[model samples]
Target: MQTHELIKALAADSRRTGVAMNTVWWGAVLVAIVVATTIFFALLGPRPDIAIAAQTVRFLFKFVVTIALAASAFALLRMLSRPETDPRGLLPYLVIAPALILTGVAIELIAAPAETWSSRLIGTNSLVCLTFIPLIGIGPLALLLLALRHGAPSHPALAGAIAGLAAGGIAATFYASHCTDDSPLFVATWYTIAITILALFGALGGRVAARW
Candidate 1:
């Protein structure tokens, strides 16, 4: 068969099976990572030390969540590649949470003054509002992606809200590992704000992506 025919055949198979290439690829990656991690943990057995156990669990959690985020990012990219449809409609919200939270952290790192950055690196009690402020944009950007894709304005707000929540949760997981504050007040304050932006991104994007 000709190359064009093969391409057509593959596209048809993909649509018929309702499986996107990135989805399958990332799914396999996730499965492999999970299997490897499981095997490693099993081989190692349980550590008697509490700190070891805690660290092991934390690493596992991070690995799993990272896989999830990768899968979600693939889904979003798949949606972007296709024409606007229900499945595509869902991708922005699926991927936005992790994207935004990471972005917020990046912003935090960028905005910190040299001394403050050094202090925070050393686990000081310094607070940087600048770091937290840019995270607020993550959710909005998620919504923007949806809007740009859909070209309508119906459900961006709701989408943004959900995206924010997802982003915040993912962000908190990493923060939980590194953050020394360990205080409900700190999490409730900063993490809450970060996720709130994710939600807004969904809401704003919902309508934008709806354009048919």
Candidate 2:
């Protein structure tokens, strides 16, 4: 076959089959959770704060899990009605969320008051806020990369939502380890905000990157 024909054939394959990016993405999440949970338990076994931490962890965990579930439902809809949609393109952002969260934390810390800095640097509330740093950047960056590679997904909104939720879920797992708020209320309010910011970035990324 000619070069142009070969290129066309590859594109046709990509459009025909998303190739189960969700399986790979969700597998990464499950493995991360299992490994992180086992390590945390082994290293920090039965601490007095375990009960309190579990309470808070439950809320955050549920939130993250819910996003994945919701995305799955949406994916089913897209697959049935929008066969051209390529959800797999969202996978790259899984690797981008942590970096963005770290950047956000650094920016916030530098701008914080010195007196409050020490406490905030070592406090639960502060750590919770820090989680947002990468959450915002990851989705956008992933979308950008995927666009450069595959052009745009047939349905940008669906792709964006999948990317956003996947990133949010992974970041929450890390946040659970680093922060110690021990209150479902705190996770529901603060953690939700962080994920929301990231999701918004994902949407924006899809819009901007799709244009490229």
Candidate 3:
């Protein structure tokens, strides 16, 4: 082949790789969201008093936490999907959601009475939260793992773990609207547990499926 032709072919491959990765990533996210949203509404929905609930700071704050987590995880997963990118630069973002939840927990403890702490942490929907978040997040996690398969992730386990986080965030965002529990204590405890299950699954899935 001619020298110029070889250079052009290489450039074309590079562009195609970038575009293909982006397309699959975005498509995975969209399909995941649709699957999650459909499952959430089919089985559960925004609480009856969501309008009144929306007026409260505590209720509003949980969405902020979930959105932050999802957004940060999505960004990190993108970096992890690319073999050439150093994902460490985005590692700090993973801390943001936890930090926000912790801050909320601190505020709640100081502002609310001590006697209510256990109840808030335990909450009324402990069983429901545990059951549904993982249930909803599973679909998203699978979709994300498929995307990782399409891309070349240097560390499939790590990439899969981040995929879990992203799926959990998306699942939690929808679940929060349905949950009546507004305390940060409940969120920090139950939401974390639910999301952790999905992350663990993602890690396992990655190790099994994302290799090569």
- How well does candidate 2 match the true structure in TM-score terms? 0.46
Report the C-alpha lDDT of model 3 over 44-100, residue by residue, as the tens digit.
999999999999999999999999999899989987876555667776988999999
Model 3 earns a TM-score of 0.92
Off by over 4 Å in 2: 1-127, 130-152
User: For model 2, how does the per-residue alpha-carbon lDDT over 107-144 read when each residue is reduced to its tens digit?
Assistant: 55576665765454444564435544354335333632
Q: Candidate 3 at 75: error in angstroms?
A: 0.6
Give residue 94's error in model 1 in angstroms. 14
Candidates by TM-score, descending order: 3, 2, 1
Stretches of model 3 off by over 4 angstroms after superposition: 1-16
Among all windows of 10 consecutive residues in model 3, the one with the lowest summed lDDT is: 6-15
What is the C-alpha local distance difference test score of each model? 0.42, 0.47, 0.91
Which segments of model 1 are wrong by more than 4 Å?
Answer: 1-17, 21-156
Q: Report, for all candidates in order, the number of backbone clashes.
A: 34, 4, 0
- For every model shown, what is its TM-score relative to the native structure? 0.37, 0.46, 0.92
